[model samples]
Target: MKILVCISKTPDTTAKIAFADNNTKFAADGVQWIINPYDEWYALVRAIELKEADPSTVIHLVTVGGADCDPIIRKALALGGDEAIRVNADSHDSFYIALQIADIAKKGSYDLVFTGKETIDYNGSSVGGMVAELLEMPYVSLATKFTLIGSEAEIVREIEGGEETDKVALPLVVSCQKGMAEQRIPNMKGIMGARSKPLNVVEPVAADTLTSIASFDLPPAKASVKLVSPDTPEELVRLLHEEAKVI
Candidate 1:
């Protein structure tokens, strides 16, 4: 089986985020980048687990970004991705990014496509579904568990109140979440092997981007915590009803 995993580079969670170019561009200086955790810990790791279960399976990783994103792709390779593909493009627009990935998936004839439920940076959670739609294939989002038997797949995902189980044939796209798999750390052997893995850079297909970022501003600073005495239950109720508006 050929499984394609979509990976993305995102600013490390602890990195200080900033904006530039009149708040229209992200500030990259001094920011550490890493594979989006959803991609690494769930989507990619689950694909690796599948490969480990079946030696004939091949896992290919793909990303949409410029040359600077190579390290992130390499990291995916180090985590057991057989090969990598880089779609040379700016992935700010979800539709455009989905187009690139969908085109690759079509040409590659991948049996299964996997991606994180959402990227940490933008948290759009749109690309995987768009890719599935563009390819006219089935897609499941926020899948917590996945199992493959022959050409059929068994998937479990979270829904409104609880988990929903599903079954789909091959040529499926899934956006994975936390319960899908455990995180894998790259060992010395895997790291060394990744250095020599094939990393193909491809041009993106033509696609019209429908949206653009206008500006970015930090959230308002958090207010100090207010304490209410246990005896003054009415005060707490009043605050929740009036100030917080959460009652």
Candidate 2:
């Protein structure tokens, strides 16, 4: 099976986020970049596990970004992806990224496409579904388990109360989350091998972006906690209603 894993470069969770251009652009001055956790731990790792099980399976990593994202893609390749594809484009919009991925998948004739449920930066879970719509293939979101049997696929997805399992045919897209597979660390040999692996660069097709960022703003500071006496219960209620707006 030929599987394409969509990877994203995101800032480390602990990085200090700031804005430039009068709050219109993210400041990348001292940020540390890493692979989005959901993509690395679940989606990409599951594909690598599938490859380990079946030697014929091939895994390729794809990312929509400029040359600065090459390091992130290389890390994914070291984890077990056979090769990498970097789409030369600005990934400011989710639809533009998905369109590029759909074009690559069509040209490569891949049977399966995998993506993380959401990126940590934006938390918008829209790319995989958009790619599926563009490719006209079956799509499963928030998949926690996946099994391939001949030409059919068995998938388990998280629902409201519990889990739901379904079976579908090939040429499928799935957005994965936790419970799919355990994360793997790249060893010395794998890291060395990744240096020589093929890294293909492709130009993005002409497509119009639907949205643009207006500005960036940080959340308001938290208020200090207040201490209330147990004897004045009515005062607490009044404070909740007027000050906290809880009632």
Q: Each candidate's TM vs. the true structure? A: 0.94, 0.92
Task: Give each model's whole-structure lDDT.
Answer: 0.95, 0.93
| Runs of candidate 1 exceeding 4 Å displacement | 228-238, 241-245
lDDT string for model 1 (37-141, tens) is 999999999999999999999999999999999999998999899999999998699999999999999999999999999999898999999999999999999
So what's the TM-score on candidate 1?
Answer: 0.94
Candidate 2: residue 178 lDDT (0-100)? 95
Alpha-carbon RMSD, candidate 1: 1.7
lDDT of residue 74 for candidate 1 = 90
